[model samples]
Target: MLLTDTHTHLYYETDDVKRAELVQRCKYNNIGRLFLPNVDAASVAMVYSLESSFPDLCYPMLGLHPCSVKENWEAELAAIKQAIHQHEIFAIGEIGIDLYWDKTFLAEQLQAFKQQIAWAKSLKLPIVIHCRDAFDEVYDVLLQEKGDDLRGIFHCFSGTVEQANKITDLGFYLGIGGVVTYKNAGLDKVVAQVSLNHLVLETDSPYLAPAPYRGKPNESSYLIYIAQKVAELHQTDLETVANITTENSKRIFGV
Candidate 1:
């Protein structure tokens, strides 16, 4: 039962002891691969450091997150581009529209998303998107940027069946996470509607922990619960869910 955490923020761990513990827990839970998504210049170093420390388990991605988009976003994007050249990034991601927190940077966020999408296409790498309270906005940009070259995961997807179909139709995978296990997230219904082939597993660690651990600090090891919930939703076994989503993750990250 080899599971892959398609999205995690191991860099968020500050202490060496906790980081080591997290790695051991993930190993015990059969989480063999963890994809780390970069937020911006501030997080690039730590993201790369974690990947460097666990070359076999952690793979790093480069991009500018929407929430980080501000007046000086151009400089941040430039820094991200420079970092990409310096590091062997797996993808261009954790990037997209995020209007949940603030709308002050909506225009800048849109520009950053589009530019990052262009970077992904140019580099021939998949992108892991971070869409929040901006589905229509994200979909609009994706529609404009849709093409054979655009392929990636809609990270942490918690949308409706119609939205799920639209994302899958665009050749993007839906990143299923702890939200699927929530009491009334309705992600279970979405899971039932979308084929497993169009889905991948994620934890968004230090964020959305699965039920029984929801609202608590999430970790890669907890991916088991999310996988189990997905298995239940698909009416299959846990190993089946893990295998399929692991393969789907590999297809996207090419690892």
Candidate 2:
């Protein structure tokens, strides 16, 4: 079965020479699809250019990442809107509130996030949430703004079964990543309790690679590592994990 990496940032700060080799390794590892999320206006061109060059392999999503919320966030939001109007992006994402690193612009981040969620609904696209140490704060915004139209995956989900149930009840998929394979990630309980339909596989690559590759630059090929761990936890085979996650991703991104 073909595996799909539902979340990856292959072009982020990547060297051209290594990019060539990295993609070859992905092919060898059975990864056929890679979803690239836009981080900011600065990275949008690169993300789309990568998608254009590898249309058969890379798919692009356009949205300002949560970490990118800053003083010029309004202008950045306008740029994101213009890009949405101009091109055919899969979804609005890598978007959400992040309170862990800094809370200086938490308010602005929420505003940008909800505004983008509304935009995603207007565009008839899903969202890709990037919650970190702020699930409660993020969920507050979601509870207010989310509706049948505002649906997508909670990328890099690491939460309680209750939280997982809450997200899944909203018809959003949980993005399981390298954290699942860690010895003490705490994702094991959530993965075991959540059904396959509410789950999607990802690496958030060039970032959180699974065990053995932990503490190193992640790649799409490492998606299989996370998928394999999910399979083992769910007491199924690797292909089963790949198949269900592929279907779940298609449902969310409409790819």
Candidate 3:
């Protein structure tokens, strides 16, 4: 069974020994593909370094995360854009409106999100969104920019069935992660209701670890747990979940 973590920040683990252990764990768990989305200019190098170290296992994506949209967001975006040009990226994201942490930069966040969407469109690449508490705002922008060219994954989607429909209708895949394993996250219910055709798996590592490790640091290796939960929710086998979700990742990343 080959599983794909459509979103992860495994690059954050810089210790070579520990990082190798993380990758080895992923391999042991059959998590063959890991997509890394850099949050800002500073993280671009980290993302690329991990990808280079595991050329066949890690894929890199570039974008200005909404939470990173500070006063100097323009400069950050410029740096990320320059980096995007210098290397091959599978997607332009973990970008979207995130109003959960602070509402101070809502306007800036919107601008950054839209700008990154434009970058994805221009590059003919998919986007990976990080919607927090601004799904309405993000959905509105996506509606405005709706087209054949706009397509990507809604990373770490923990929304309602209605919202899931809205995203899938836009040709975007719903990125399910460790949250689904939470006893009360209600994401399992949503996943059970939605078809696997419009769904993908992720870990969003260094955060949102699944149950049995909920309060600990998350890693791509734990993706097997998330995949197992998804398989349980869908009433299917692990191999089926792995096959379908990995194929969906390939569809989105074109890799």
Residue-wise C-alpha lDDT for candidate 3, range 28-106, written one tens digit per residue: 9999999999999999999999988999998999999999999999999999999999999999998999898999999
lDDT on C-alpha atoms for all candidate structures: 0.92, 0.88, 0.94
- lDDT of the structure predicted as candidate 3: 0.94
Count clashes in each candidate, considering only residues at least 3 apart in sequence or on different chains. Answer: 0, 0, 0
| TM-score of each predicted structure versus truth | 0.98, 0.97, 0.99
Per-residue lDDT tens digits of candidate 1, residues 1-255? 899999999789978899999999999999999999988899999998898888999999989989899999999999989999998988998899998899999989998999999999999999999999999999999999999999999999999999999999999999999999988778898898889999999999999899899778999999999999989988999999989998888888787
TM-score of decoy 2: 0.97
Candidates 2 and 3 compared: the better one by TM-score is 3
RMSD to the true structure for each prediction, in A, is: 0.7, 1.1, 0.6
Global local distance difference test of model 2: 0.88
TM-score, predicted candidate 3 vs. hidden true structure: 0.99
Q: Candidate 2: give the clashing pairs.
A: none
True lDDT of residue 190, candidate 1:
83
